[model samples]
Target chain A: AQSVAQPEDQVNVAEGNPLTVKCTYSVSGNPYLFWYVQYPNRGLQFLLKYITGDNLVKGSYGFEAEFNKSQTSFHLKKPSALVSDSALYFCAVRAYDSNYQLIWGAGTKLIIKP
Target chain B: NAGVTQTPKFRILKIGQSMTLQCTQDMNHNYMYWYRQDPGMGLKLIYYSVGAGITDKGEVPNGYNVSRSTTEDFPLRLELAAPSQTSVYFCASSDRGSNQPQHFGDGTRLSIL
Candidate 1:
């Protein structure tokens, strides 16, 4: 079964500090990973995706994610966090056998304290 | 470009009432999906359509129905509202396939009492 896990329910980071939201996956074959961010009362915005490219993928709003194939992980990262970066983060992997279905992670709340 | 649009941003429904959550995408996406996000939980897919007149059930589709009559419109129908159905509903669309990033609407907040 293909599944995505966001181990941490919440992550706290101070403003201007580096932040990381961990995500790991279990899949049968090479996976397509994606990251999305959701602000309060808003829909998710696409951050970045790893189809078949460099290990480090850059996305919107100065956010980036590293796809570690060996670790089966795709962790969202930012060199310098801001107060406005506080939001919910989700990780997903495309189902190997399904048409357009994605296995989504439970989500991680990122809190950036100023 | 109005990427994806969902109607009735917020709603409250009584038990046994039925309602339709409308979704439309101007991107002419080939794939459309309906997902419900409950508090503290990840999204659960209710239905999806690959194209016009091609709808299929997803992970949790017991109490809901969906129709894709055209390339741009995919609406989710709740036959009988239930307390358990209270959730934030998100409608998304992708141009090519799962590998492509999905575009989402603002989402509809529905509460069933």
Candidate 2:
């Protein structure tokens, strides 16, 4: 079974500071990891994804994620955070060989404070 | 273009009542999915269809049923409304190939009382 775990319930970062949302996963074969953001009363928007090759993947809104096979983690990172970046972040995974079903993590609330 | 569309942005149903949540997509995606998001919780997959006429159960399919009769439409049926089933339902669609991110609808807020 493919699953993702977001250890932190919330992450607070100062405006213009670097932000990080942690995620780890367990799956069979290679994993396809994804990051999505949900603003208040809005549907989820795709941030980025890591399939194969390049450990670092850049996505929308200047967000990026690094895939660490050894740690089974794909942590979302942003070099500079803004108040508008405050939203719910979700980490999801899909097994390369299994049926196409995205397994989602509990999600982490990101609060960018001034 | 409208990526995905869900009807009845808000709905209230009494216990034991049944309703179908409608979903449609315009991207001609071969994969469509149904998910429910609870407050402060991650979205749980209710069901998915690879293509028209082929549907499968997801992690949380109990109390729910889905049918994909066409490439652009997939409707989810709740046989008996329950408080536990009250949540925001999202409809999404994606291409058949891997790594193709799914596009989501605004979502339907269903309330069971």
Candidate 3:
């Protein structure tokens, strides 16, 4: 079964500083990894996805993620954080050969302190 | 164009009551899904439909039922509501395949008392 683990429950970063949210995955076949962000009282918004290509995948809102096969990790990154960036982030993984029913992490709360 | 729409933004039900949460998509997506989000937890899939006539159970399908009678609508039914079923439900849709990104509705918050 494909599964995603987010080690951190919450991450705090100062505004204008770089931020990183860690994610790891376990799957049998090639992995399709994705990142999503959800604001309070709103549905999740897709950030980025890594199917197969460059290791560094850029996504919406100046966010990017690095897919490291050896480490089995895909961590989200941003050069500069903003107050509005504070939200709940989820990491998801799906097996390439399957129907893409995603398995998601518990979620990581990111707080940008000004 | 309203990407995905969900009705009954908020609802409160008594125990043993029944209710349906309505969902519709204008994108003409062939794949639709229902998920519930509990406090401090990630979303759990309740049901999914590959097409109009095909529906399947997901990870957390108990106490919940769903039907997709058309390409645009997928409604979730809850029979004999319980406090354990109270949570925020979200409806999402994607294209025919698994590679497409899922578009999500605002979500419906349901509480059982």
After TM-score superposition, the amount by which residue B82's alpha carbon in candidate 3 deviates from its true location, in angstroms, is 0.9
After superposing candidate 1 on the true structure, give the runs of residues whose Cα lies further than 4 Å from its correct spot: none
Q: Least accurate stretch of 10 residues (summed lDDT) in model 3 chain B?
A: B94-103
lDDT of 2 by residue, B1-113 (tens): 98999998999999999999999999999999999999767999999999999999998999999998899999999998999999999999999877889899999999999
> What range of 10 consecutive residues in model 2 chain A has the weakest lDDT sum?
A94-103
Query: Candidate 1's residue-wise lDDT over B30-103, tens digit each?
Result: 99999999977888899999999999989999999999989999999999999999999999999886689888
Least lDDT summed over 10 consecutive residues: which range in candidate 1 chain A? A94-103
Error of 3 at A90 (Å): 0.8
TM-score for predicted model 3 compared with the true structure: 0.98
Could you arrange the candidates by lDDT from highest to lowest? 2, 1, 3
Better of 2 and 3 by lDDT: 2
Score candidate 3 by lDDT.
Answer: 0.93
Cα displacement (angstroms), candidate 1, residue A1, comes to 2.3
TM-score of chain A of 2: 0.97
Per-residue lDDT over A1-114 for candidate 2, one digit per residue giving the tens place of the 0 to 100 score: 567899999999999999999999999989989999999877899999998999999999999999999999999999999999999999999888868888899899999999
Question: RMSD in angstroms, candidate 1?
Answer: 0.9
Model 3 clash pairs are none
lDDT of 1 by residue, A48-89 (tens): 999887999999999999999999999999999999999999
